[model samples]
Target: MRKVIFYILISWWLVACNSSVISPEMVDECPPIYPDYVGVTIPATIAPMNFSCLDGEYERVDVTVTGGKSGEVHVNDKIVLFPQDEWQSLLKENQGDSLMFTVCIKKEGKWKQYRPFPMYVSSYPIDYGVVYRKIAPGFEVYSKMGIYERDLSTFEERPLLENTMVPGMCLNCHAFNKTNPDHMSIHIRGQHGATLMQIEGECELLDTKADSILSACVYPYWHPSGKYIAYSVNNTRQSFHAVKDERVEVLDLASDVVVYHPETHELLLSPLLQKKEVFETFPVFSSDGRKLYFCSAEAKPIPEAYKEIRYNLCSIDFNPEHGTFGDRVDTLIHAAAMKKSISFPRPSYDGKYIMYTLSDYGNFSIWHKEADLWLLNLQDGTKRPIEEVNSEDTESFHNWSSNSRWFVFSSRRGDGLYTRLYLACIDEDGRVSKPFLLPQENPWEYYDRSIYSYNVPEFTNMPVELERRKVERGIVSDKRIQVKVRQ
Candidate 1:
């Protein structure tokens, strides 16, 4: 009803504008476009995959999209800008179908039609949007950065919190419990260093460092029940690479994993996870909350042996009922045996697959050019690289949608400096499709001169309910509840 009326308004507006349709000379080659939406499978609820011509001197673009169900949408402009309501209607009508795009452009007073392309629509739907950090690529300086959320259905992005809001503070390490915006945990560093969390609609500021803990919490993941959050306390250090195009090698001196319960303000410590001879980080809970997955490496001398640091995928039984851990640990994927490192191990909500980033040696994969996404089949214990989505550049920091049908990853594939977000679909039978870039009203306008890099992308079922006043109040109050170490 509302969509139909809005779509009608769009059609009437397009007709009223009286834009002249061009008859283009047919060309055999497809038009090279930015973001490359051609032949990629995307969720029906995604934003319009608008793109701009990359090669020619074009002043206007005209695209006609025809669905297999006979739904058609045409628009003419300098770039492809599909009507929001009409795009939604078209997608809803063409789920599990293909859309043929006939693109034409006017260049030098003549119109040319390129070879048509097909964009497949996946039957599965994505989350409401994604939440991620946008930060400048300054390795040594305190640059402006913020955590923002975007609506997948439209071109809208809003900041959950920014460093500017709390002056001189660095914001990072944010996590939500299984896409639930209500259960969120974000960290702030500076004079009022603390972790701001909202669990079950109750907000609290916590100073997670206890007397026994080595350092502050980093790389957090929420338990399924929303009662516990696993965090890695690390003594982190970094050094610059002398070679060109090399990034700051962020290395861990010492790290340990601990689980914190909000109700009792207790940090559960396990000697198996925090052994002095071992480095553990990036802990996440299984979908059923019965197991804890993390990355572990044998501790070596810092800086000199950093290249020898290889983390393997491991897990331990977790008793959510008693807030306890098992006596033994199991090595799931021995990445070190193959001279590879695993970082950011994320389990699917459906419990069928675990996606992780694999690099050569070090755990900091974002800077490792060989970093690629791999899928671990938990049911059969088979793991393989997601070949269809992997490129010649870095692909790290990935998360699955709540439905486990789609995944979002940050890649340094474009220009090899700034990380851009790309989404790919995986059907129930585990067929991964070619990844597509995050859409924008004018992608070229933004990506052409953007200086910020996308980081830590994760899907969310709803827009985060972070009240600016509440976060600001937490920053100003400088009060945090101290968590105690569990005996």
Candidate 2:
């Protein structure tokens, strides 16, 4: 009898161990995960999108990811932490396929399984990296800020320049020529303010403010030929709101658009872009460099009539060889007639579409909570909001990939305050997929703890390389090349 009882006890212990493996009891609702990665499309080269359960009831969790063409990954923890090597291998093997995840949680010694979800991995490859400014989303005062570049294929970020390098100064508006990091431009504001340009791997500091121009260059767009840069010189002002939803309002008291020729050190001014009654800003050169697109608004009274300001989308002809503007400006989209204002007119590299932000009023859509992305189809001249990638919160400052298959934009969708970078894929038919948050190793932890917002998220074909100490010395030194206006 004693021998029989010992054998029976050993068999019961074996059964208990097997039961702890993954014997889910009931089919419960889907597991609540941070970042809401469900049903989103992702690039195969992107980093692992680590997530955690928002519900704290689970004591233990198991996630089983099965790639359609690759092996399976089994992770056991309260939070899903994928192995980097295994995740990369899985994505490689399952490109242009789907990954299904089955999440099972243990609560009070009972296991429950949720409905499985799918994450499609697109075959379309994204840019190698992205560069943007990391600053506190605040009003007037700014603390420590820096321009950072992150590799999309991995979780690595390095600063190109920071405020600590030059104390009491602010750096912003970094632009690249056709996604070429070797040719870039950035602005520094403070006692030593100048536009820093890198051409073909050489750096030069220039004072873009000429005697005729209203103010220094604020918004910058490089010409495809690399000989010229289109800029907007604006007399900008700021105001604060007493309401809770609205905190600040930034408007241009006076503004105009101009092009700068680095080779000749001359600033090109068009009478149409610089008018007393009109405000023209946010100029961008077309992919072929034959036209310039900008935003135009009727000048209104200062902060008193700020809510009545609305900008219309307009374009003008450009002669790259002679660096001259056309005789007449053409109005593309009459945004004011539609009770909307447009800003940041970014044309795709393929020249098929132009994407801009549309708000109820004003050019500073970053502070406008109703701002969303609008796409203008150049082929049919039809425009519509990209509802697939927009949320109820603010969506501003977007850029397209070199191949025009992906776009990165900044949105205040996470917590409704800090702007985070998001990536979305676009098909040949101009259909945008649901956007996913810029993947982090630990998205929940990183996003929750971060205090800075990602502004001006732009894609780059290569990493931005700059000497930190050299840039600091150049900014501090009073050696600036003065730009002259073309007579």
Candidate 3:
């Protein structure tokens, strides 16, 4: 009855879509598409790269995807949509090659075909998903926010924990050891300020503030061995601008970097990183766990001299077994010499390069319109701006994929205010590719009405399994393990 009618309708729709497409008048130029997937390389496991015509006046769009492996898919509709199973199958069959895209659009009953483009398929596989913080695009107060995990293979996102668990709480950036969820850490700020630590699948809430430190743990990065976690504690303050171009400036009155020994419940101190005149933050363990990389800027007067604060890409030796730092600090890339600043120095897991954010001045590059991405070659010590992936807008808070062949970064490129997530590829020879926006089932509609901004995107090898009920109780109960041992 109804079931047979539904099946027959579906069959007819498919046939119509498959048979109704006609040869269109060829044009010389390419179609201007949203997301601009043109010439972008993607892994086989990524979600379908669905797109639509940027000019919405079109009556319909016809897309033909053809790969060198003798695979093809056609769609004729208002917006181009590919069948998920077929898209996956085609991508899998075309690894290490490219697929051609021929887009034709019908506007007011006439059909015209644009020049074809190519979508590269990389042989390298990406991580399972990414974990990030989603918060309202404001700095004064955090009304609602959460740490979420998204499966890259699909458009599925689930929140690990939301501020609703305990209202007025803020969830800062989360970190994992080599993309393994077994070792994770997140900083919670508010009345229930604490650091949630998970080591080898065991989770605990820790009051990470100590009398000797400037403040509670803020930014976190885990050592590969899981023996130590590096953090930067800062006495931070913010100021608003009266001018038109600038809005906010985050200046650290004082900051220092330290390492935490999970097994011993101790804080490893290093005076080298705690100099009174030097402000240090954004600590990360290097690829082999033998070095710790961080950002350092000469401390300046509060808000008056904030523009002079610039951080350099620096590193210090570390002994993972001993949970200790080297005596001397090295300035890997001194931005002050060039009158520029660097922040968020993320070294590739394969130890090939360090990608960082550069601005005119100040360590808080996210608020700087001049902020852009720069790459430092580890082997030769030469550095340059990543022009291919950078835009005229701010690019901040980037992370490397587990495979080191891909990277994800936060950019305010589209409209210069709403932060969006984009992913790009960098090959072994230091060649970079144009980045594509993070995929959505319907990107145009999703981004237009979005109020929240994506920040601190991190790749995870697998989905993070956390028990929200237990965590809510832990924070509500106000019980936390002190990082410093009891007297």
Q: Rate the local accuracy (lDDT) of all candidates.
A: 0.91, 0.90, 0.88
> Would you estimate the TM-scores of all the predictions?
0.95, 0.95, 0.95
Worst 10 residues of 3 by lDDT: 15-24
Give model 1's clash tally. 0
Model 1 lDDT-worst window of ten? 15-24
Candidate 1: clashing pairs of residues:
none
**Per-residue lDDT of 27-55 in model 3, one digit per residue for the tens?**
99889888889999898889888886886
- Per-residue lDDT of candidate 2, residues 276-308 (tens digit): 899999999988999999999999999888988
Q: Report model 1's TM-score to 2 decimal places.
A: 0.95
The true-versus-predicted C-alpha distance at residue 362 of model 2, in Å, is: 0.6
Candidate 3 wrong stretches, greater than 4 Å:
1-19, 485-487
RMSD to native, candidate 3: 2.9
Task: Decide which is better by lDDT, 2 or 3.
Answer: 2
lDDT of 1 by residue, 350-460 (tens): 999999999998888999899999999999999999999999999999999999999999999998988999999999899999999999889999898889999998899
* Pairs clashing within candidate 3: none
